[model samples]
Target: MTYWQMRLALLRHPISAALAAVNQSGLFVVAIMGTALPAVFFLILLNFGILLDATQPSPSRLPILLHLILLQLLLIGLMRDAILGSKARLLLISVPGHQADHKVSMLLATLVNPLLWPPLFILLSTSPTNWPLMGAQWLLPVLLLGIQWSGLFAPAPSLVYLSLIFLLSLLPLSQPMATWLLSEQGMITLLLMLLLCQKLPIRTLFNRLQRLLSHLPLPVSSYIAQSVIRQELHGLVLRLTLALMIVAAGHLVQTQVAQFSGEVQTLTVSLLAVIAASWQLPLNRFLSAKREFLLSLPQSKICRATLLGQPLLLGLLLFQFWLHHGEHCWLQIGLLIMQISLIQIVTIRAERQFVLASLISTCAAMVLFVTLAN
Candidate 1:
């Protein structure tokens, strides 16, 4: 096959396509830049401080190297989705070709990915002396990256293997003592661990573990619903998690910091609104496909269960803050309620206008509430 056709075919694979899409949309670009820029900038400033102190040179270099390696590990590990990998493998199987050719094509397709290079460059630039050694070190990350890609397209058994290896690697990394010891072996050990974790067998293990867990005696319907909710609320979960962490940290500064309280509430409410608004378009498509299913259900049940569940999720978030602070901020609660209500109402009445109206109303409400509360 021609090069463009091969590239297109790889992209069509589930795992590769998602990665490519994530890379193309500049989400990965933004995330990497967001992470790397501040890190590098701050490291530069810190390096100057270390330069003035000649006594602790080794400590500084070691910590800097360790930190950079950790950052790369975090970025790659978190962003590698097994679902995407499975999808890619399916496409590979369907294509008529020599298996080796497909593997080579898949490898080359990864080269076009913006995600791979930026972090590699970051790693290289951060430790130029380590560059020559990185070929050896890179064996792990490259292997893991490739294995993750392979696992996506591989069979269930293969996914199980990959997952098991990942878990085993992670188990050691989790212990404080192990982590410190591993770091002492320096960049080479870290790179090897990364590569070993990336192998196809590891991914297969992971897939198998997931399948086992999924078959557990849980309420299948409820579990399915929750899975949907979690998938849809992924972005909101990250925002909430970060906001809660910040608010918890701020508690140390002052028990009754009005500034922290207001900032936390406003941010929490705004993020929920953004998340609710985002669901509008997707929900429309979902509802269109399942019009009959939705229609068969009682309006009251739908309103109470599905519709109210959306707001209640936001409410629970606000309630969490209230419980922590021990303050009945009616105004904050009202803003959150209104934000959720406004999004739902706009979504039902004018699906097309939901995005713009959601933004305008949420911003306006936040501004007014913050103004009056302060």
Candidate 2:
């Protein structure tokens, strides 16, 4: 097929169509923000940079570079799903042409993408010192852009090979030799060379990764239940756990900073109560499902069973908390239990309305609490 024909085929694919829609909307917003905000920020940064430089040591530049590298790694990690999507591979393999022709065609197709140029501009603008390594730096963007385009059409076999190369690249090498080579020619050249070697290998690697994910012998319903419970409980448990741990660690800091005994006690008790309440949140869905199933049987009343389950779940949660933390703060715990029961009733009446109202109220309450607590 001709290059244009291959491009046309890519556009017709389902994944491409969905991605195009998302890209169109994203590009419009991004373009607007990119134009308006950067100018304002650059002017602010120019003034701030002078003041910051006067106060901060020159050695701070290393930390700034490290932060930039970490941020880039995070961004690249987030984009992995978009890179690995099935549509990407279809586009890569669709061109019935030579390797160089495929590479060039894919590169051209990528350049047409609105997402490609902005990052290239940002990379060039931010690290002008590295511009002396222009030949190597240019290759990084080109290779990345090409890889992104090819990944959409890369076969399953190619993905597997790519994964192996990625793993291999993580191994530690001779530090002095590596540093000498990287510093002399620049790290981008090394990155590009490594990427080029893995290009053909990725198709095989991806198939293995796909099979591994697909063949994992986990029940979907059980997994979903576990995930839901984890997500629901995470905010409460993680926050409370971390807060308590930090409080313990920073006891001396708190004392030195003027400790408020009443506030500390109240906040600690409130967090414990909140964590207790969170346990029943997942039980709402479980009880609701059970109620529905039981109502279909010969002798169960849905309303009675659901009402009974609420108290039973609440009691169980209270007992669990009591066992862990003891019965010292019963009043606040009782209030939390009542609040959770009420939430469950409201949730059953109209979940969407209840959830929206609860979220708004929770946010407002949190703001008020933080303001007052401080």
Candidate 3:
């Protein structure tokens, strides 16, 4: 009873919640098949390694690998919430030696995390012969466990973890001097730093920043936009990651696969745009619920537009960077606009409806993409 409850509590942690959101979004099957965005991202990294040296592995990839590990830590921090619910907290804390039990439960949750398994499985399968790289890759999960365990006792905001991860990621940029930073000794040192982070005045620093932001005389829309972005951050990051992976895959196909037609490439990109636009459904609902209050504010039209355009702007920037090399730049941008506009028409009301709408919208977008590409 205690074990399962503890496991459930750990499973509800922010890291798991984001993944759950993905699963609810109808990508659970893709995740199970190990073809998910995280897996593709890792494979892309390996492809980069291959580009560096088709004959022999390169050590330069180590720094980037560290960066990915740091990313995982940052994700945990971003999605983090209270580790235990009120009832679970009361029940679990009453168990004798509950700390040990909680650690064990956390370990189980970390292993079973769907978002993590794909990348870790890819690393193990591909690098069995390369023990050094394999060992280095395995450190990601360990670091995840360590950071999450720390969160169980002392939860810090994502910004604090991001700052620490950023500082650590920069340590490997100098190559020769920084190689030792990823070594076994270096990993132990990093773990110590992770533990020591609990000692920082994280709550105080976070509060000060929030208070400063609140005091600023910002428009109602800008303020709401910030709040909505923070609230939807987990899902937003997941969707953007999916979009980027699709874009990267399309880039790889275009560059490497000559037999694949332009129509197919465009279809892939259109699907990417649709994935990017999926976040807007939730964004619309979030705003719609507050419609009455927002209308009460002055310049509400401008605020509403600004709030709504935030997601689209992010999608535009991503596509712009991806499509800058193309000849028909304006045409491609138009196609992207059509793709986003098309998906926004399909609203999400329930799980089944969302799945149905997503499939129908994606197919429609693909047809649109293929037609435009020709």
Candidate 4:
């Protein structure tokens, strides 16, 4: 097959192909909306930069910020094979190129996506004061790609190193170096990232998860059950990291919101819901297939079951506030719990358009609670 044919084969998975057939119009709408995100992001960032400059007239870090996000996306594409199902992995391996060449092709394909262009435009739209910084911005990808190339032999280490870079850069010690992500001083973080790219034991982590999961034999009564459990097991690291981030976000947002307003809370709750929804999606389908009676539950009963433990969530948030601020942050705690609970409830129960349900429910709940709080 030619290169483009090979890329096409890789992109068109069985599950997605079936879904496209089932809902072509919906899929087209989704594609259009997904493509529009870059435009939306570009306008938002461009205007924000303009507003900030109008207020204080400083050189913008906007380009560095965009490059950092692009770096993460590139790393995620590299990690895709590691996270995807065995079936997908097998199919990918069957594609007719050397692994390095295949990865290069995937990288090229990912960078060509229209969504990434907006950040460049956003940078360009900034004042000429940002031009010097923009020159440095182009080097960010080169540094990350260089680090990625150096770790072609150990994808796991490469990923772990990247994650560490992100985490450490958020720490106080790295703050001085964080200002310019592509300058010589900025290369400190990248150098530290490359140094940390020694072989990580990610395979061992997977092995341990498999051992524990196989001990109970994976609920293999059906394909859905088996696939759900396998994928869940494979996701232990990601799930754990997200959980930790959620916990930290819960505490950190009280401080962050003084600057960013409810956007931080909105994003935090949205993320918590997305993670919950992702887990619940396949599990709900598997259970509905297996028990069938779960489908027979009264709507009230289902709502009660899903919305259970609110008091606990509240208590935890209260404790999070005390842990971070040593006082009753009633407003913060209430807003977070309401937002998270509303989003999770919709995601768990709503059978169709999970994203829409979660967003509408969360937004409505947020508006209602904020109005009442005020």
Q: 35-54 in candidate 1: lDDT tens per residue?
A: 57676444344432332222
Taking the tens digit of each residue's C-alpha lDDT, what string does model 3 give over 57-81?
2344443444444445544444444
Q: What is candidate 1's CA lDDT for residue 359?
A: 64
lDDT over C-alpha atoms for residue 143 of model 3: 64
RMSD of 1: 9.5
**Ordering by lDDT:** 3, 1, 4, 2
Off by over 4 Å in 3: 4-67, 74-87, 114-201, 230-234, 237-271, 317-334, 345-374
Q: Could you give candidate 4's per-residue lDDT for residues 184-250 as a string of tens digits?
A: 4555556565655554468888789878876775322333434555655434334333433343433
Worst 10 residues of 4 by lDDT: 24-33
lDDT string, candidate 2, 174-238, tens digits: 54443433242544544554356455555466588768967888544444445445654423333
Poorest lDDT segment (10 consecutive residues) of candidate 3: 50-59
Tell me the deviation in Å of residue 197 in model 2.
Answer: 8.1
What's the TM for model 2?
0.34
* Clashing residue pairs in candidate 4 (N, C-alpha, C atoms within 3 angstroms): none
TM-score of each: 0.48, 0.34, 0.63, 0.55
Q: Residue 203 error for model 2, in Å?
A: 7.4
Q: Ranking under TM-score, best-scoring first?
A: 3, 4, 1, 2
